[model samples]
Target: MGVEGGLKCVKILLFLFNFIFWLCGLALIIVGILVQVSLHNTFMINDAAASGVPIVIIAVGVVIFFIAFFGCCGAWKENYCMITMFAILLSLIIIVEIGAAIAGYFFRNKLSAIVHDSLTEMITNYKNTTAEFRDSVDNLQKRLKCCGMNSSADWKGFASDGNTVPDSCCLNVSSNCGKGAMTDPTKIHQEGCRNALETLLKNNILWVIVAALVIASLQVMGIVFACMLMRGIRSGYEVM
Candidate 1:
């Protein structure tokens, strides 16, 4: 094929790649919002804190969207300046993402310990905490079918209204079973919230790593296309 035809093909491929890249960014933004909403009312007793994670994710998504826009424009116009800019930005993003993925790998291993500590703290402060916080913990227990941070023994230390455990810790959702179940270990949840939360965070981190790698691969392709298209544009200029 001629140079013009090859250039056309490259531009089309670049446009399609950027369009999909932009969609990935949009998906990331939605995921970030959902995560933030899910964890909004929940309390975190960790020293590192969990509050900023969703915000950072949202910001990364926004930045990706803008970078993809630059890529799309560069390909469409076959502009050397825009393509060079896009390539530079994409390279920087890939480097940052690699670092993030590495950090996530180590973070995943430590998540269980951190969550264990956080849950223990939450259990300690449960009664003194607000109703919303209390409800959040209750919901977690109910959904995970677990009790306290480690065992029902964790609730033994809590003395409030003569109840050993919350209603959510019962075998059934019956209010009558709640107090009585505390005495009968068989009637209460056998597992603990710490284990449940740890499992959940591990799964989340895996998905996050997978997603980052996928996006990074796409970004690499974009960088290649941007450079090739820039070269083609310069060649065409010389031919003219």
Candidate 2:
């Protein structure tokens, strides 16, 4: 009776572990799906520059979740064939992660150089535009002086007159000025460059290292759990 009770306790523990694993795997899968959807939405709203990191994260999450789910199912069913399949899949995931980490380490400097070049070009363009706009504003302020009586008058008409100002300067000041005010071109460029660099580091190297370690550890745990399930299933079969 004591032996039977002890076996029952072990079986219950195995069942609980299998369920917990499955739940965590399913949650990760759902998170991956959501991340992918968000990435798509970001791309639609802006240029293609916004989609890289989320897509990479989704890919990693999906791979981990599917491998874990299969392992849990294999353990729960106590099927040697399923267990063997999951083991193979986990091994492949670990290898791929390791390869990614190695590639990222070697190419990191090149990636940084590309990001810096792009950012420098963008900043240069922004500085040129800003200087031109500031000069135009200074020139206009020097020419126009509206006192209390003339302040409420139509300065647009005066500004448009051929005798008062050049047609080129008067042409759509609001449109040009509004765009400059609404968008800090320099800041936008800097942010884009920073994001691109961060994506490479976080997704390619850091995440690969972390995921590889976790998956390797989990695979070891999986082997031990599979053995336990096998013993329990065989014992149960014999008892019946």
Evaluate all candidate structures by whole-model CA lDDT and list the values in order.
Answer: 0.74, 0.43
TM-score, structure 1 vs. true: 0.89
Go through the candidates in order and give the clash count of each.
Answer: 0, 0
Which pairs of residues collide in model 2?
Answer: none
Q: Which portions of model 1 show Cα errors greater than 4 Å?
A: 35-46, 49-55, 160-163, 183-186, 237-240
In model 1, the Cα lDDT at residue 219 comes to 84
Candidate of highest lDDT: 1
TM-score of each: 0.89, 0.46
* Residue 175 displacement (Å), model 1: 3.2
Q: Residue 239, candidate 2: how far off, in angstroms? A: 9.7
Q: After superposition, how far is residue 193 of candidate 1 from its true place, in Å?
A: 1.6
